[model samples]
Each structure stands twice: as C-alpha cells, then as structure tokens.
Target: DQQVKQNSPSLSVQEGRISILNCDYTNSMFDYFLWYKKYPAEGPTFLISISSIKDKNEDGRFTVFLNKSAKHLSLHIVPSQPGDSAVYFCAATNRYNNNDMRFGAGTRLTVKP
Candidate 1:
C-alpha cells in the first residue's frame, strides 16, 4: 500500500539557502519518521529523524518536523550546499510493530552553485 507520498518529484535551490521537502502519510499507525539522502549509485544514508512524541528534531543544519494531527512531515536543510544535492526519501514506521518501514517516492534535490 502507498501509505507515504512525496508530491514534489524534485526541488532546486541555490547554495547556502534553505531547502524544504514535504511528505504526507495516510496511516496513523506510523509513529517514527526518517529521512534518507541517496547519492547516485549509492545506498540511502540516514539524514534526520523525528518521533511522534516530539514535533521537531534538529541535527546541525538538518531538521525534521512532524505534524501528527495532519499526518504530515517535512525536512529542512539550512544553508544547503552543492554536495547536498541528491534523492531524499521520507520514511515512516510503527515502533511497536515489526520494522516494516514505508518509503515515499523520493524527491530529487538539486543545490545549485
């Protein structure tokens, strides 16, 4: 089932600017959220995460915000760099259930110089 969705297929941003990525989920059972960055020919790497207990989580220039009521989430990259350009995947999972993570169609981010 396509419980997670990334409406934007791609985003372009200038270097040193902020990039916003949005995601939505239909399942209310998801309590854990994660964002992964994937480079060409490489596996997706963990970027940032947020749990249902918190509305926001930040790690350095990367931040993730969760709106439980709206069943939505977003990832913000501050001062985005050219190296940050990649395909970003939004994922959701229920901690109580087996780790059956659901991933949205990745959104390709291009940070231009």
Candidate 2:
C-alpha cells in the first residue's frame, strides 16, 4: 500500500518564479515530513523537513508546510532556477519507528532558464 502520493507527476516553472510540489499521505502515524531532491544519477538529497508539531518550516529559498488535518504537505521553492530542476520526493517517518520510512513516487520539477 502506498502511504504517500504525489498527485502531479511533473511541474514546470520559469526561472525566478515559485515552484510548488504537493504530497498526500494516508498513514496517520507519520510525524516527520521530509523533502528530498534527486538528480538523474545521484541519490536523493535532503532538502527540508517539518515536524507534525509545526505547520511550516523554511530554509533559505525552500519551505515545507504540513497540514495535519488534511494529511497533506507541500514544498515551495522561491526564485526557481535551472539548477533546481530535479525529481522531488516527499518522505514521511513515524517518530516511534524511525526505521520505517515512506516515500512518494516523486514529482519532477523543471525550472526553465
């Protein structure tokens, strides 16, 4: 069963604009949310994360927002650049069981120059 889902398979954004990636999860046990960016050949790299205790988290140009009631989360990138083009994955982990983590299929983001 897929616990996390990224409804949009891909997104295209112009440089300097904002890119938004959305995710939805079915497991209510999840408490930690994370966003990862992956290139064609490289492994997924951690971008930002948000705890269930908080509704939003931001790091520089990246921000992650969580809506517990809706079981949804979103990642936003400001001033999108060509270098930001990558596949973004939404991940979730339960605090009690850190070993078991769930990941979304991923949304490919293309930032046009």
RMSD of each: 0.8, 0.6
Instruction: Report the C-alpha lDDT of model 2 over 6-65, residue by residue, as the tens digit.
Output: 999999999999999999999999999999999998999999999999999999999899
Clashes of each: 0, 0
Of candidate 2, the 10-residue stretch with the lowest lDDT total is: 94-103
> Model 2: runs farther than 4 Å from truth?
none
Give TM per candidate.
Answer: 0.97, 0.98
Estimate every model's Cα lDDT from 0 to 1.
0.95, 0.96
TM-score of candidate 2 against the unseen true structure: 0.98
Off by more than 4 A, model 1: none
**Highest-scoring model, TM-score:** 2
lDDT for predicted candidate 2 compared with the true structure: 0.96
Which pairs clash in model 2? none
